[model samples]
Target: MKVLVTGGSGFIASWIRKELAARGHSVLVMDHQDRRQNLAPDEEFFLGDVRDATAVTEAAAHVDGIIHLAAVLGTQETISNPRPSAETNILGSLNVFEAAAQYGLPVVYAGVGNHAFRLVGTGCYTITKSAAEDLARMYNLYRDGGRITIVRPVNAYGPGQSIAKPYGTSKVRKILPALTCRALIGSPIEVYGDGTQISDCVYVEDVARAFVTALEHTAVNGPTEKPVEVGPLTSVTVNDIAAMVAGHAAAVTGRPVVDLVHLPMRPGEIPNAVVSSDTSTLQQIGMTAADFVPLAEGIRRTVDYYATQWLPGWLQGMQVSA
Candidate 1:
């Protein structure tokens, strides 16, 4: 199969691209920026944005299916600037759907599991993502046929994820990378609110497999049925995550301890929210929680990755080019 993956340079998309290529599928990556280093030799790349219909159409022309993953992420980033988030997540997604509809291509959309039930807060990131999911459903209903499959993934973490430069930067907001980096550098790990807000953190490789499965699955369609929830069957609180990161850091680097600093939760933050995998949907897709990487093990791998792989390359990039 020839698969077109939007935002192929992103963390999850990177894994999806590699997985598809490994499964003997030719991949065509379309992203606004060039992160060609993540691509395999058998994969092709196109510099394009999902917002541009022409670009999206050109990219989807010869692809057997589409995995739509391009969008502005981060709750803080989206809440801080809603316009661009709306433009990119909503309008940009519409362009992708329209193009896919034109080409009669099957689409596998990446959505947030949190929004699968009820949105606790009105964060722009969730709002725009939910809107895009609606657009995907609409396209499926009114277009050639219902050839869309929605995969709602929980908080996905792993190596190759983007992190703030200069190491230990406070601007790093993603939970996993932020905690991992702070623990490695002996900085206090910041936890928002009471540190009890629950999240289901799935490994990137697992999420990548779910996307590939959804793209190939012929039974997914329409918006009436619930989207397939991909993640661990259990949930962990924020405080639990902090402790896990600290423990993994200690184990990996032989550190004595790591401190947790409680901070007031930011605006648009959901309190007491928990995300869990829908077993029925997973069963339908022939997946189970046992197939996922254990949280503690995943955390340990992530800590090592940031400490060894990501941090060193970032520091090297900062060196003066003479």
Candidate 2:
């Protein structure tokens, strides 16, 4: 299989590229970002944006399928100025689908779980992604030879996550675990409102694997068959995840973590958001959500990754006090 992974240099897409290449498939990594260290030697790399239909079409000319992962992320980034958000996510997705249709290639869209449910905040991102998902379904129904699969990922996290980055709605769920670790390490952990909001977190590796499975199981003949949802189906609360993060940190540091309550809930925050995916399709296709990495273990691994790979620069940039 020859696969094209957009935004291949990003946190999740990078892993997807590696996974595809490891499975004996040829991969073409396309991204506008100047992040070269993420690609493998075998990947045909192209520095490009998805918003350009001509570029996308040219890139899709020879690929068997596409893993569409490029999008304007970060709720704050998107909602602040909808023009850029609309142009990148919505328009970018259309280009991918149109190019797929033109070249008769299968497509598996990487839609965000944060946008899967209605929320009070992050309107910009949710709006564009919602539009994108609708386009995916539309392509499935109308486009000939265009198989469209949608994977709604709930709070994917693991190594390569930057704690210092913006906490957009897609990233807010991460606050629980991040603050928990802070507390365990005797640092102040902030919480918005009473920290009772409910959500779910999955590992990035699991999400990346789901994309691969969907691409492999794509129906070449029937474009309307929606491949069943893949990845974790369990839900956890913000408080629950926070406590778990603190527990693991305590175990690692040999000290009790601190809980620091902070400002009120952000405007438009969802009180409770959970996902109920029918995993029968994914399982029948020989993929298991249980293969999804456990959140607790994933948190520990993520923390270790930050410490080893990014802690020095993070501490220096953030000015963590002793």
RMSD in order of candidates:
3.1, 3.3
TM-score, candidate number 1 = 0.91
Weakest lDDT window of 10 consecutive positions for candidate 1: 217-226
TM-score of each: 0.91, 0.87
What clash count does candidate 1 reach? 0
Question: Model 2: how far is 153 from its true place, Å?
Answer: 0.9
lDDT of 2 by residue, 15-121 (tens): 78767877888988889876777557777887789999988998999788999998876555565667877888899999999999887787888876666544445
Could you tell me which residue pairs clash in candidate 2?
121-268, 183-257, 183-258, 184-257
lDDT of 1 by residue, 190-217 (tens): 8888888887799989999888877877
| TM-score of decoy 2 | 0.87
* Top candidate (TM-score): 1
Candidate 1: what lDDT?
0.80
After superposition, the stretches of candidate 2 with alpha carbons farther than 4 Å from their true spots are 119-122, 165-185, 219-224, 260-262, 275-281, 312-322
